[model samples]
Target chain A: MRRAVGALLRKDLTAELRTFESIPAMTLFAVTTFVLFHFGLDRSSLEGDLAAGVLWVTLLFAAVLGQNRLFVAEEEQGGFDGFLLAPVDRTALFVAKALALFAFLVVVEIVAVPAFGLLLLGPDLLDPLPGLVLVLLLADAGIAIVGTLVAGLAIRTRARDLIAPLLTLPLLVPVVLAASEATAPLLAQAGAEGPPGRWLAILAIYDLTIGLVAYGVFDFLLED
Target chain B: MQAPAILVRDLHKSYPSIEAVRGIDFEVARGEVFGLLGPNGAGKTTTVEILEGYRERTAGIVSVLGHDPGQRPRTLRERVGIVLQGGGVYRHVTVRELLDHWAHLYPAPRDVDEVIELAGLGGKQHERTRSLSGGQRRRLDFALALVGDPELIFLDEPTTGFDPAARRAAWQTVRTLAELGKTVLLTTHYLDEAQALCDRVAIMKDGRILTIGAPAELGVGALYRVVWRDAETGEVQSRETEDPTGLLHQLTSAALARGEPLRDITVARPSLEDVYLDLTEEPSAAASQEVRDG
Candidate 1:
């Protein structure tokens, strides 16, 4: 099972690297959306709840672009059938795909977060760097899990493009909520502050619970 | 004694509005090449998919290598390889990279280089899949299936659209699998393909097997077509008869005595293609006859 997961993950990352399919598009979307937020509110800088809301919302929608293309090569090229033919555990596919999406999210954040800092963030980006990274990582995990599951489900339908984001946005509302709440303090203009521990706990629990649910149901989606 | 490679009895499968497979029965012996010959919508794919454990059967029994495929156990998957018709390969990866990746999925896979050679993909290994021609991609599909070193392989419509040379090449690949002592189950609509590759074939239509037999045996009673031109009016005449030799002898003897030889004379036996057409075209009669034979 581990070998299968490793092979699958490596293939996804290799394809992404060769084609630059998911990450570049996702990163570009994030940066472009940030610029839009800057002008849409006509605000020179954002802080606290407003800043946190803008960042997570833009990231969540950008992640949707990643989710939409997640299973396309597999679906178009019969990758799912190839994977299903193997003797390994099916859950390994769920793990590999979720992790691949997680990696893409992290890479996008690596660039997008800094762009956010330079463009519209009022706080000294270095002051809240540590806590903000934690919040971003946790939120990315939640998005990755739910996004993988929804991507699997939506790919089976003809309306996958229209359906993936429709399904993903609602399911990811909790992650967005928890992540924004956690980052609000760190981005506060008054000074850097540690995020309340409860939001982190909520993000962790959400990841675990949904991760279990996605893992359990993913095998069925692979069939037919 | 060891059981057959595949044993399916009274199998039935239906979708919401259609009965895709209605109680079909057949068995393929170990190391044998079996084909399900049918036209489009003849339920060939549905049956093969059911055997591969991709879809569930609506009724009856199915056993592949002495195991129920519906359960899709890991051991069964480890032993069975499948080449789904037009199943996609990752276009971004090179041929060697893709094959190496698939090889790891199996416990004891064939060497990737050997598999590439076996599938006739030796020189193109370094090229990305998207760069390969259509025929090359199909060869890649075969390579992926063979990478597992499986005991039984399922090929659903392996060569539906191919030029004459490509089709023959595909046939050679199937022959290679048979030489390796692997049991193969393939579905194809090409009559010549079935005759050239399959040891035995089951003709199917409208969710049922029309008839199953060795290619030569199925045409045993089918007629031969004899055509010739008449000396008197220079017109062409043809006849379908059970005995082409007797018919030819009579015509030639009369023509020799009359001092004019027959023109455009040709006698052709009914091949497997003829048998397939006869069975598939007249479904109602054939189905009842099969039921009575049972």
Candidate 2:
């Protein structure tokens, strides 16, 4: 199972690296959206709750862009059939795809978050770096799990572009709420403190619950 | 004794508005090539998908390699290979990369290069699948199926859209698999393909098995045709008979007695296509009665 996951992950990462398909588009979308946010509000700098809201919302929508394309190769190319016929456990595919999405989210955040700091963040970026990283990673995990599950469901439908975000955005509202609320304190101009433990717990519980549910149901979706 | 590679008994599948596969039963012996011959909307794909464990049966028993496919037992999956009709491969990846990735899915897989070569994809291994022609894509599908070295392989309409040469090539690959002592259950609408490749075939229509037998024997019991022309009158004549050989002997003897040959004499046996059309054109009275009874 480990070997299967590794092989799949390597294939996806290699394809992404060669084609520059999903990650670059996602990153570019994130940075561009940040610029748009800067002008939309007509604010030179944002802090506290406002700053947290902009960061998570921008990242969430950008993550949706990556999720939309996550399973396009599989649906268009017959990757699902190829994976289904193999002897490996079906959960291996769910794991590999989720991890691949997670990796993409991380890569996008590396650029997007830092860009957010330099562009519109009023607080000293270094002050909140540790807590902010935790919040981002947790939020990314939640997005990756829900994104992969929703992507699998939506990819086979006729209205995939509209369906993917529609299905995912509602499912992800809790993650966005928890992540934004958690990050608000770290971005406060008065000082940087660690995120409240409650939101982190919520994120962890959401990840675990969704991850298990996705793993359990993924096999059924793979079936005809 | 070893069990048959596939044993289906009184199988049925139903959708919301229709019954896709109505009670059908057939068995494929070990190491034999079995063809499920049917037309569009004949429930051929539905049955094959059920056997492949991609879909569930509404009723009846289906066993692939002695295990129920509905259970989706990993042991069964490891032993059976499936090449689905219109199955897709990744368009952006090279042929070798795709095969290599598939190879890792099985515990004991065939060598990636060997599989590529076996599928006749050696020269094009480095080309992205998107660049492949339709024939080449079908070959890649075959390669993926064979990579697991399964004991029983399911090919659903393996050559639906191939040109003559590519179709012949696909046929050769299937024959090669049979030659290697593997059991194959193939579904095709082409009667010639079934006649050429299948050791035995089951004709299906409207979710039912119309008849099942060796291609030569499938519709043979019905009648044989004797065609000839009268030498003196130059009039062509034909008759359907249960005893073609006896009738031909009598005609030849009479011709010999007259010191002349039986002009334009020809014996015509029903091809599988002829039989398939006869059975599938419309459900016979007896078959419809059976459906009503069920």
Candidate 3:
């Protein structure tokens, strides 16, 4: 199981490095989303409540960009056949892909989050770094868990164009809501800490439940 | 006691309205290239899928490497390899990189470079799979299946789109796998392929095995076709008979006494394709023959 998971993770990460398509698309999408938020809110209303809303929406669109490009690399190169032929358990394939996606989303956030704070809010929001990273991690995990599984299935469906957004949007709503709420405390409290541990707890629950169910069903759904 | 590589008894699988696999049974012996020859939609793929533990059986017993595949054990999977019909791959990675990733799955894998050469991808190692020609991509698929040095490998229409030369290379690979002591269960629409590579083949139609036998024993070459031109009207005539040699001698001598030379003659033996078609064409005959074989 360890070997299978490791192989899947290695395959995905190596592919990401070779082409670097997903990262650029995601970064550009993330940056564009944040810029859109700035234009919408303007100077008068650029507070933490507004920042929290903007960040969640930015991540949501960025997550979609990353997810959309995820399987295209495999599909374009005709490598999923190799994935299927690997001795790894299919669900491990799921986990490894989710982790790779989680990594990609995190990298983009690392750049986008800070950039959004400094550029859009003029240095005031950078103080929330620690709490913001934790919130992003929790929310990204939830997105990665469900996103990887759905992306795989959607690509195989006849209605793939419509199916991807249809499946992902519903799942993303919960994470987006939770993430928007969690970042509230970071901006509201100066040194005042972050969203209560309960919101993070909700994020954790969502991540764990989706991971377990998706893992259990991955093999049954995806096989040669 | 040792176990058979695969054993299926009265296995049945059904969808909502139609049954795909309708209670067929067979066992693939260890270290042999066993074949399932059938046309499209003939249920061969479904059977192989079930045996690989990819799909569940609606009704039957199937034990592959002494484990039920529906249970999806990593151990059973560890021992088996599969060449899927077709699917996309991770396109961005180079062939070598992709192979390196898969090679890590097994405790003992062949050297990546050696595998690339074996797959006929040596020169294309640094190329992405999407850039490869159809044959090269198929070779990569074959390489992936054999990476783990598995005990049992299931190949479905494994050489469907290959050119003649590539198909020959694939045949050699299958032979090598058997020589190295792997049980291979394969399905192909090409009769000559099954005849040349398969140690034993089961002919299927609808959802049942019409006949199972060595290529020669399956009535191939049992009957011969003889064509000769009649001297009087310069017209052609043909007869299919069991003993073509004997018939040829008698016919020539009879023509000689009558002072007429047999002209424009052709003699041919039955091919595996003919036998396959015959078996499936007569449902009653197939059922009885299957019973007799059992």
Candidate 4:
């Protein structure tokens, strides 16, 4: 199972590196959205709730872009059928895809968060770096799991590009709610602080619950 | 003494408004190449998918390698390989990369290089799948199916779009697999292909098995066709006969006495193609009315 997951993840990462299909588009979309937000809000810098809201919303939308393309290779290229024929547990695919999406999210955030810091954030990003990392890790897990599930559901549909975002956004509301609420204090102009414990708890719980559910149901979606 | 590779009894599958497969039964022995011949929408795909554990049967028992495919046990999947009708490869990934990745999914996969060579993808291993032509992509699909070294392989219309040469190459590969003691279940509309490769075939029409047997025996018995031209009038003549040899002897003798050869004399048996078209076409108009009136 571990070997299968590793192989699948490696294939996805290598393909991404060669094609530059998803990550660059996502990263560029994130940075551009920040620029748009800066102009749209008519503010040189955002602080506290406004800063948190902008960063999380931008990340969410960018993540949606990645999710839209998640299973496209499999859907278009017969990757799903090949994978299905394998003896490995079907959940191995779910785990591999979720991890790959998480890695892509990390790459996107590596660029987007700094852009957020440079352009829109009023507070010092370094002050809350450790706490911010924890919040991002937890929030990204929830998004990754839910994103993979939604991608599988929508990829086979005729309106895949449209259905992906529509299905994912509703399922990701809790992740957004908890992530934004948690990051708001970290970006406050007054002084940076750790994320609130309840929001962290919410993020963790949502991630765990969704992960288990996705693991259980993923095989059914692969059926003809 | 071994169990049949596939044993489907009274199998049935129905959509909300259509009975796609209605009580069909067939068995394929191990190491045999069995062809499921049908026209479009004849429930060939549904039955194959059910056996592959990709679709649920509405009713009846399906045993693939002695296990119920409906449960989709890992053991059964490990033993069965499938080449689906559609859904292709990762366009951005090289052929070698995709093969290597698929190899890791099975417990004991065939060597990636060997599979690449077997599928006629030797020199193109480094090329991205998207760069491959249609025939090349189908070869890649074939390579992926064999990489697992499955005991039973399901090929759904494996050569629908191949050129003549490629089709012959695929047939050779299927023949080699059968020689290697692997069981193959092939679905195709090409009667000649079925006749050439299959040890036995099941002809399907309107979600039912119209007939099942060796291709030669499946056609109506003693129905040989003789065609010739009248030497004097230059008019063509034809007849269907049970005794082609006797008829040929009498025709040639009479023509010799007349000092003219029996021009264009040829005797042929009814082909699998003839039987298939007859079986599938005979029921359509009546079946449509039955469906409409149901």
Predicted model with the maximum DockQ = 1
Residues B1-294, candidate 1: write the lDDT tens digits.
789999999999989999999989999999999999988889999999899998899999999998999999999999998986556489899999999988878899999999999999999999999999888888888888999999999988888787777787788899999999999999988888899999999999999999999998887777889999999989999999988889999999999999997999998777898888877875588788999998
Maximum-TM-score candidate: 1
Give DockQ for candidates 1 onward, in order: 0.67, 0.60, 0.51, 0.63
Candidate 1, pairs of clashing residues: A77-B88
Docking class of 3: medium
State the TM-score, rounded to 2 decimals, of chain A in model 3.
Answer: 0.90
Runs in model 1 deviating more than 4 A are: B14-22, B221-230, B233-252, B262-269, B283-294
Q: Can you write out model 2's per-residue Cα lDDT over A1-224, one digit (the tens) per residue?
A: 99999988988998898899998899999899889989999998999999999999999999999999888888876778777777788889889999999999999999998999988999899888988899888888999999999998999999999999999999999999999999999999998889999999999899899989998999888774
Q: State every prediction's TM-score relative to the real structure.
A: 0.90, 0.87, 0.82, 0.88
Residue by residue across A1-224, what tens digits does model 3's lDDT show?
78878877777777678778788788888887777667766663355666687778778877877777666655655456555545566677788889988999999988887778765654366677777888989999999888888888877667766787788989888888888788877866345365778888889888898889888887766763
| Candidate 3 clashing pairs, residues 3+ apart or interchain | A73-B91, A74-B89, A74-B90, A77-B91, A78-B89, A79-B89, A79-B90, A80-B88, A80-B89, A80-B90
lDDT of each: 0.91, 0.90, 0.80, 0.90
Best by lDDT: 1
Q: For model 4, what is the error of residue B104's alpha carbon versus the real structure, in angstroms, after optimal superposition?
A: 2.1
lDDT of 2 by residue, B267-294 (tens): 8887898898988887789999999999
Worst window of 10 by summed lDDT in candidate 2 chain A = A76-85
In model 3, what lDDT does residue A40 have? 65
Worst 10 residues of 1 chain B by lDDT: B81-90
- Residue A38 displacement in candidate 1 (angstroms): 3.1
Candidate scoring better on DockQ of 1 and 2 = 1
